[model samples]
Target: MITAENLTKRYGAKTAVDDVSFTVRPGQVTGFLGPNGAGKSTTMRMIVGLDRPTSGHTTVGGTDYRHLKAPLREVGVLLDAKAVHTGRSARSHLRAMAATHGIPARRVDEVIELTGLTSVAGKRAGKFSLGMGQRLGIASALLGDPHTLILDEPVNGLDPEGVRWVRQFVRYLAAEGRTVLLSSHLMSEMSQTADQVIVLGRGKVLADAPLSELVRSWTTSQVRVRSPRAAELADRIAGDGVTVTSAGAGLLDVAGLPADRIGDVAAAHGIPLHELTPTTGSLEEAYLALTGESVEYKTKEIA
Candidate 1:
């Protein structure tokens, strides 16, 4: 398990991470999410002792990462895929890393096969493509078969099959009662892979909870209504903050109103209704709703 208590990182006058306190428990995948400048990378660095915190501290299995005699055996980290030596082959790179922790040569071959890099294990790191480099990084991270894993954008350059493989692999590790903390920009994949989510914005944690609970509490419930007089019904229901948008011909997407209320309004106005579907909410919508204000770069829509 990973525990961070009031973790803060500062660079001169700018604060990268501020008073961030969260617990990443074992046997689950905890997603670390944020905007471009939301300090996700900095927090991860602090967790692994790559970057020192300004005020607070972080721990892996209740011990600082730097204090671990053999960090690879206790915790695995994949912050940058390009951190390997360019002149070494994939197998040689893993062997060098394994050598540090007294890991056997067979374990290196096992991780190479496990990460699907067996075919290119003898290839030089400099010639590997971005996706292949990511695989090599994963292979190195799993070389020691550590109990805790911290991966940042693990599927950045992966294909569809590779992405699925990573999703399943992390989930498998979690099922084995290992701690897994993942960071990614793909909301759809995160929704499918992560059991819990921690959202950061403006160098602070905006929300942290189970994925289902975050979706349920942050996003607004909407009802999709299809009727002949869609525009009329929409106008009738448009009051205060209620929103109604036309999806297509005779289809209206209504928000801030329940499905039953929309049905009653249509029935009272003698409008023929074809469908009434309630959408609970989605992870993307919930993320935007929670971090909309914390966005550092805003783009104006072309109207």
Candidate 2:
């Protein structure tokens, strides 16, 4: 498992990560989510000891990345997929990473096969596509078969199949009792992939909980009603527990009540409706709602 306690970083006057603390447990996928310039990359760099923290501590297993006798074997990090030398072949890059920790060439072949880069393993890394470069990066990370994996935007430029392969790879690694800490701006993908989430905004944690818990805390399910007498229907629906608002022309959005119950109430009041449908909130919607007031860059809603 990877644990960070009040980890912070500062470069001159700007505070990048401010006392941010969270733990990534083994046997599950924990997503690190934030907007652009939310200090996610800075935090990942601190965890791998590439950037020293200004305060607090970060640990992989029981030791910091620098303190570990074999750092690569303790934690495999892929901060930048393009951090390799361009002239070398993909196989040579993995070979060099393996040699650093005294890992064998047999293990290099294993990671190449595992990452599905066997076909292009002999080609120069600089000539490979973005997808293939990402695969080679993963191959380098898996060279030591480390227990902890920290990848920042692992699926940045992949196709659909590459995305699926990454999703499965993270899950399979966790199933084998390894820790995977991944960060992305894609909330929809996180919803389908992560068991837990750590949400950040402006160098601080906003929410850290299970995915379901975050959804429940941030948003609510609603029912939409469309009728000719929209105002009167909305007024009637706005009683004890339910709150109603105008959604659009001749449409009302009602919350704090299920769709079936709303339908029953509307029918009992002799209300005419052209549509009555349940609208489930998306994870993206919930994320925006939670961080609406905290956006670093706010433009008017185009819609």
Candidate 3:
């Protein structure tokens, strides 16, 4: 398990990571989400001891990262996939990382196969595609077979198939009792893979809870109801403190009210209800709403 207690960091007058606290439990994938320049990178750096925290602390297995006996065996991290040397082959890169802790050569080969990079394992890393480089980085992280993994944007440049492969791989690892803390800006990807979430904005912890709870509690669920008596039904349901949106012809989207209450309103007015279904708010909608003020917009070419 990994835990951060009131952790913080500052750069001159600006605070990079403010009093943030969250727990990443084992046997599940915990997604770390934030807008650009929201101190996510700084927080991750402190967790692995790459950068010192300005205050508070973060621990892995109840011990600080620097205090671990074998850091690689305890936690494997992949901050930047492109940090590998361009001249070396994927196999050589893995070998060098494994040599640091006296890991076996068989382990290197096993990870190479596990990441499906064996076909290009012997080729120079510079010649590899973006997806291939990501695989190589993942292989290096798995060389130690650590119990906890901290990956930053693991699918940034992956193709559709490669992205799906990574989703399943991380899920499988967490299922085996490993703690996975994934940092990514991909809302759809996180929605599919993460069990819980920790949201940060401007160096401060904004929200932290189970994914389902966060979505349920922070978002306004809207139900779309359609009926032939659109005018009378909408009139009966309107102005009762519930926010209702008309869908033109004969449809209405209901919000700020429960399904039962809508039914009661319809029954009180003797309006025939044709449809009533429970609606779920999307994770993306909730995330955007939570971090709306912190988002940094950029105009880049569409991929």
Candidate 4:
């Protein structure tokens, strides 16, 4: 598990990370989300002791990362995949990392196979593709078989198949009772992988909750209805806090009423309904709503 209490970071006169606090429990995948310049990188750096916190504290398990006797065996981290030495082969890189903490050579081989880098294990790190570099980074992180994993944009340059593999791999890790903290810009993938989310904006904690609760709190549920008597159904369902918009001759998009409630109303009025489907708000929608004002770099609209 990872815990942060009022963690803060400042560079010169600017505050990169404000007082933020959150707990990432074990046996679950927790997603970290924010727009650009939101201090997510700073926070992660602080967690791994790459940067010192100006105030408060953060810990992997119950001790600071710097204090862990065997840091690699306690927590695995992958902050940057491109930070490896350009001259070293992928296998050599993992071997070097394993040698640091007294990890055996066979464990390095195990991680290489586990991360699907077996074919390119002998290739130079500088010549590897973006996806292969990411795989190597992940292999290094898993070299020690740590109980906690912290990954930053692990799927940044992966293909569709690689993306799916990572999604499944992280979920599998969390299922084994390990703590996993993942950061990603892909909301659709995060929605499928994460059980809970902690959102940061401008160095402050904006929201932290389960994925379902966050979506429901920030977005509205909608139900799409198709019927020959669409106009009549719209008029019947129109009331306070309810909205109905016409899509076409036989379709109406409804908000503030569930499908079952609308179906009951249609049955009572003897309306011939062709379709009634409930559409819940997506994670992308909820993320946009939560971080709308927190976006630092806004693009201007083109005419």
Q: Could you tell me every candidate's TM-score relative to the true structure?
A: 0.90, 0.89, 0.92, 0.98
Q: Give stretches of model 1 more than 4 Å off.
A: 229-245, 260-273
Write down the lDDT of every candidate, Cα atoms only. 0.94, 0.87, 0.89, 0.94
Candidates ranked, most accurate by lDDT first? 1, 4, 3, 2
lDDT of 2 by residue, 1-303 (tens): 888899989999999899999998999999998877788899999888899999999999978888899887878888889999999998899899888889999999999998889999899999989888888887787788889999888888888898888898898999899999988888888788888888888889988898888887788888888998889887776778788989889988989888888777779988888998887777788788877766787777777
Cα lDDT tens digits for candidate 4, 121-148: 9999999999999998888888899999
Task: Provide the global lDDT of candidate 3 against the true structure.
Answer: 0.89
**lDDT tens digits, residues 121-197, model 1?**
99999999999999998988888889999999999999999999999999999999999999999999999999999
Query: What's the distance in Å from true for residue 175, model 1?
Result: 1.9
Q: Best candidate, TM-score-wise?
A: 4
Stretches of model 2 off by over 4 angstroms after superposition:
224-236, 245-252, 266-277, 297-303
Alpha carbon RMSD to native, model 1: 2.4
RMSD of each: 2.4, 2.6, 2.8, 0.9
lDDT of 4: 0.94
Clashing pairs in 4: none
Q: How close is candidate 2 to the true structure, as a TM-score?
A: 0.89
In terms of lDDT, model 1 sits at: 0.94
- TM-score, candidate 4, is 0.98
